[model samples]
Target: MKSSPQLPPGTCDCHTHVFLDEAKFPLWAARRYTPPPASIEALTALHDRLGVERVVIVQPSVYGSDNAATLHALRTLGQGRARGVAVIDDHTSDAELAAMADAGIRGVRVNLEVDGERDAQKATQWLRRTVERVAPLGWHVQLYASLSLLGACADMLGSLPVPLVFDHYAGAQAQLGLQQEGLAEVLKLVESGCAYVKLSAPYRCASPDALQSQEPLTRLLIDRNPDRMLWGSDWPHPQPGARPNASDVCPPFEVDLGKTLNALASWAPDAATLRKILVDNPRRLYGFDA
Candidate 1:
């Protein structure tokens, strides 16, 4: 068998999803896309091969507010090595939230891009209420909104009681380059320790060339607040639909773990910084013990 890339002990993949046994955990009827099953076993093997010791299973939009699949995966992966981010609405009860916390879920996700303006008002209300509910649990809010939406919600996001984690570079458009709308506000959040940005799935937001070209932005974020940064594989990369207004489509779903690691290594100036990105930052964010 091929060897996994060497990484610091306690390295964590801060974002990933486990779509398993759809028969048991069916997709939401209103889901935008149906992804192939990427089971717990597959995720474990992938993480093991990447030399990652811990993972965070983000609840995909396909499951809507039903986090059974994510919760099940967390249990299968074992609480000691796994944490989760779930999707919830105001209808979710405190007992349910308590159960999720016991099952290793430490955060909630809000996908504005998927919800759209038709539901925007309700989604915003849900977000505010959810934030209030989870604040007492010491849980962060994970968001998958576009740059424009992010900029529009900047003030409210900045005022969130818990930490805010922006998934996939806050969905910045590659064609826009460093001048991407709302990026400046995102940088401010990072600078102020009010947010975290995951350096994951560059393909989702930027073409390979654009990603390479935007090294300065990446470096600026890292340099500005290394402590508020995190990394993830976005493994079994889910393709919900064609990116809106993006001239280039995302590459194939296959994730090259080594290449991802190499890119991260290239972005970091030294081993210590790399360790922080791979280990320390995630440890702090996800409550992974040293």
Candidate 2:
């Protein structure tokens, strides 16, 4: 087996998901795809093997707005080692939000991909309301949307009251390289100090050859703002239609975790910059204590 990369102390995998006992935390009936249960025990083992000391458990789309699984995972992985980003709507009560804040939820996720195309007016309204709700708590908004939608919402995104985190390379389309529509807007956000982006799931956005094409874009983003960058494994990659059966517990899907880590490492100008991306940046954004 290829050896895991040696990461700095307090290195954080800023993005991951844990799907525990299905009977206890069932998938949303309207979910676009079903994922195999990736229990907290399995995630911990992966982290230990990868030499990752901290993590951020993001609420996956399959669970919709029900953050029970994400909350349970965070409590189980306590000791200030794990934080969470929940999926919530305008109806979510202030009491529930306060409770989640105490439980280590530091942000709210707005995933536009789940329902596909949406009316621009309604989407903007939802974004505004959600941001207003989370801003006072000093929480950020983690956005998972398509490039087109990102472009459409760029102005509002830049104006939000809290920090913005764009997921999966800002949903850039691989085939277009740096010329991808909406990418410039995202880069501008980073340049203006209005946003952060996750260097993760390259496979989701780029093909093997296209992955090489991403080098320039990756380097540019790192150079533009290393402090605004974060890394994640996107573990157990849940592809569309990948449903898990309750009868069998299969081996986890195969992904070259080491390779992903190395690719992100290559973009760093030096050891210090790498530490900033893997450790310092996450600490600041996720509010991890020194």
Candidate 3:
């Protein structure tokens, strides 16, 4: 295996998920995909090897809205280096939100592409409420939805006092291409400063017929909004429909981590820009300490 990329000082993996043992944290009964087991210890080792200094653990949909696993990992990795994004419902109490904030959780995630309708209205309401409660604490709302859904949310998002972080290049893909009308609206949001985007999942956004064709689209977004850009690993990747297998057996779909890190630098064309994507941007957005 190739050695992990040696990140610059203060580097951060801005987006990723940790799937724990189901014997302990049972998978959601309604999960759309079965994720392979992943752990904080394993992630720490990955980070150590990669030379990444910080990370933001986004709660996966397979766990529904339960954030206990994410919270516990944040507590254990107490270098003041890790933060988290959680999924919550409207019924989540003010105290619970505050507790999460104290536990290095600086954001809440609302996922859109799950197998079934997962209560978008309630999730939006929860985000609205949580944003109000966490405003004093400087937290943001991390949104995991397609470009179309994000376009719909753009107007409503401006009313929130916190920042909105978009995942997976705002879910634009080569198949949709630039002609994807919804992405134009997204670019406007990024331009208006209401949105931040992660340059993760370039593979997901690539055309199933041709992966190399994705570069132009990814580079376009990077050029358009370098300051608001971020990078992620999406580690222990949960490929849809495939049976879950060990990393050694399945090997994370064979993308080159070192090359991915290099691509971020190439896209932005500056060391400081890449650092901001890897470090400062995520730290400020997720409230990780320096």
Candidate 4:
């Protein structure tokens, strides 16, 4: 394994996942992918070695609504240094939400892909209710949804009391170029200042699957709003079960962590601007110490 790169002081990794150790919590039957062991101890050491001062443990889709692993990871990391985004359903009670707040979970994830909408209306209603429930805790709603639905949900998102965060560069179609309507809608969201967007996962968003091609959209998003943007390493990328091609079995491409840091220059401000992405912005969004 590569030695973790040293991060700037006060840096924060705003996106990373924690998977339940099978020995402790067995896999969910509906999980679409099997994640490798990503324990709290392992994650902390990654931060220490990388020089990241804080982290946000986002709930991976593999766990669905089972946030025990995420919560446990938070407890292990302790308050001030760590926070989390949980997967939740409409039936998640207020007490449960309150307890999550206490446990340093400042966000909830709505995984539209896994939740598959037989009826889009029903799914929308469920999501709306969830947003209302967590509003009091000052928690943002983290979305992993199709870009096509962004405009349709714009009105609903504006009604939300807390900020909304979109993952994977707003799931844009890299082949279609930035003119893609989905990317435009994402820009509109940021233009209005109602949402925060992650500049992580360029590898997941690029055309021909090249990180360099992703810089244009990254530039656009940062240009739109520097304050609301953040960056992360989707650490230990779960190797896709089915190979896209021959390279599937080969070693995956290295995440150019510095490229993300340097994107602050192309997209928005300089390293100081990048500093907010690593430090202040997350502290405000996830309630970590500044």
Task: Pick the TM-score winner.
Answer: 2
- Candidate 2 residues lying further than 4 Å off, grouped into runs, are 208-211, 242-253
C-alpha lDDT score of every prediction, in listed order: 0.82, 0.83, 0.76, 0.73
Candidate 2 TM-score to native: 0.93
* Candidate 2: tens digits of C-alpha lDDT, residues 217-285: 778789888889988878776665444543333344467787777767776788899999899999999
Task: Name the weakest run of 10 consecutive residues (lDDT summed) in model 3.
Answer: 243-252
After superposition, which runs of candidate 4 have C-alpha atoms over 4 Å from their true positions?
Answer: 1-6, 115-123, 207-209, 239-268
Candidate 4: minimum summed lDDT over ten consecutive residues — where? Answer: 244-253
TM-score of 3: 0.87
Q: lDDT tens string, model 3, 14-34?
A: 887887777888777777667
- Model 2 scores a C-alpha lDDT of 0.83
- Candidate 2 or 4, higher TM-score? 2
Q: Which residue pairs collide, candidate 2?
A: none
Model 1, span 158-262: residue lDDT tens: 888899999987777666777777888888888999999998888777664444754666687788888888998898788766454322233336556687677
lDDT over C-alpha atoms for residue 222 of model 1: 89
Best by lDDT: 2
What TM-score quantifies how close candidate 4 is to the native fold? 0.87
In candidate 3, how many Å is residue 127 off?
A: 4.9
Residue 145, candidate 4: how far off, in angstroms? 0.9
